[model samples]
Target: MPTITIKNIPEELYEALKSTAENHHRSINSEVIIRLEQALLPRLKTPKDKLTNIQRLRAQISPNVISADDIDDIINNGRA
Candidate 1:
């Protein structure tokens, strides 16, 4: 396994990581690895991609108006 070394981490971040490690009963090394995974693994979608997805989903669903009476009816009757 390749060893990684990080330097010049801020004191506040270092203290927070230490506290998080203690809270989760993890070693500093394990906590760092988990933090790295959580930080790096999510693929951020672009605004255009998000808008396209919303438009596609909206196209598939029919638009309908829900009146206050309809909402009250559903709340009272437990059915729509």
Candidate 2:
């Protein structure tokens, strides 16, 4: 395996990476590898597949009850 050293990373970004690594109970190197793999992998989902997933997720949650007013409020806030 070849090792590489990256220099001149911004302090904020390095800190964020360190924080994320700590949150996941991984070393910075391991977390970086995992993130790189996720970024590189292809996730091919069709519109139908996405809809099916949404439906499945909704089904998994019991008694999904959000009022129309709540929906309207969310839309209004997003528009503002």
- Which is the leading candidate under lDDT? 2
Cα lDDT computed for each candidate against the true fold:
0.91, 0.92
Which tens-of-lDDT digit does each residue in 33-52 have in candidate 2?
88888899867899999999
TM-score of each: 0.50, 0.59
User: What's the distance in Å from true for residue 72, model 2?
Assistant: 15
Against the true structure, whose TM-score is highest? Answer: 2
* Candidate 2, residue 3: how far the Cα is off, in Å: 2.3
Candidate 1 residue runs with Cα over 4 Å from true position: 43-80
lDDT of 1 by residue, 1-80 (tens): 88999899999999999999999999989999998888998768999999999999999986667878988988989853
Each model's RMSD to truth, in Å?
A: 7.9, 5.9
